[model samples]
Target: MDRISALRNVEDALRAFEEGDVDLTEAERRVAATLRTYASELDGEDDVFRAVGDPAVDGRVVVAASAPAARERVLAAAGIDPDRIDDEGDVPEFDVERV
Candidate 1:
């Protein structure tokens, strides 16, 4: 699957879980699989980029790269506009259990 579709699948699974359509275990499994695919795609790319997101905020994803320009490219690949990210402080703390 393409990166965008993979990301959408993750979002859809989370929404289903939140609506009580699926259990946490099922949600985690689906998310993990989708993320693994997404990560593999990123790995194949020449540039180094890391995709990060917070469970607290739905559909909030950020791509970190070696440089600002590369970061913009990563964000674009994920269909995100870098300007939309107001500030670094907007990113929530990583909550291992919640995520």
Candidate 2:
């Protein structure tokens, strides 16, 4: 769906929660579903990627034009400096794969 429609759908979910029509958990589920739908339907060069390997950045999903950019995005999302090392003094390794 378009960005506007996505926002509207999320707003409706929030409104339902506010009006007590749905519990918080259900509202959260609806919002998450909307986001997943919106992200998956992105146009152009962007594609969804999943991070794997190290636990710190594992399972993170990011939308990027390429795997490298997705790796950077996942690190940023996890709030870990790309150059930072782990307790073992090794830079955390993660591979970004197309979803």
Candidate 3:
């Protein structure tokens, strides 16, 4: 699936979690892990997506990168194979200001 679709899936899963449609401690954790893996698949090396805590309920995961493309790369690099990442998102802007 494309990046937007992937993100949408993540959002959907998050919504399911919020609604308690899945067990927070068990199924949610698995779903969260799958989400992390999917994110990593899209991000590849440019970004880092990892589960930071236990898989149990409330476990936190972080997705970060120096560049948005890299973040997508991290997702592209998921250990598990995933659909190709289209890298679809507005680029971030960085400007230097003199003190």
Give all candidate RMSDs, comma-separated.
8.8, 2.1, 14.6
Clashes of each: 0, 0, 22
| Comparing 1 and 3 on lDDT, the stronger one | 1
Candidate 1 per-residue C-alpha lDDT over 4-79 given as tens digits, one digit per residue, 9 for 90 to 100: 8997999999999999999999999999889766654564324334434444433433334444544455456555
- Residue-by-residue lDDT tens digits, candidate 3, 1-99: 456765677677778778888656755575566666665566353344333222221123334545444333333333322253236632222221111
Model 3 lDDT-worst window of ten: 90-99
By descending TM-score, how would the candidates be arranged? Answer: 2, 1, 3
How do the predictions measure up, each by TM-score? 0.41, 0.84, 0.30
Q: After superposition, how far is residue 33 of candidate 2 from its true place, in Å?
A: 0.7
Q: Model 1 residue 7 lDDT?
A: 78
- Per-residue C-alpha lDDT of model 2 across residues 1-99, encoded as one tens digit per residue: 889999999999999999999999999999999988888788887999888889987888899989888877887898867677557755558798877
Pairs clashing in candidate 2? none
Q: After superposition, how far is residue 52 of candidate 1 from its true place, in Å?
A: 23
Model 3: how far residue 16 lies from native, Å: 2.5
* Candidate 2: stretches off by over 4 Å: 86-90
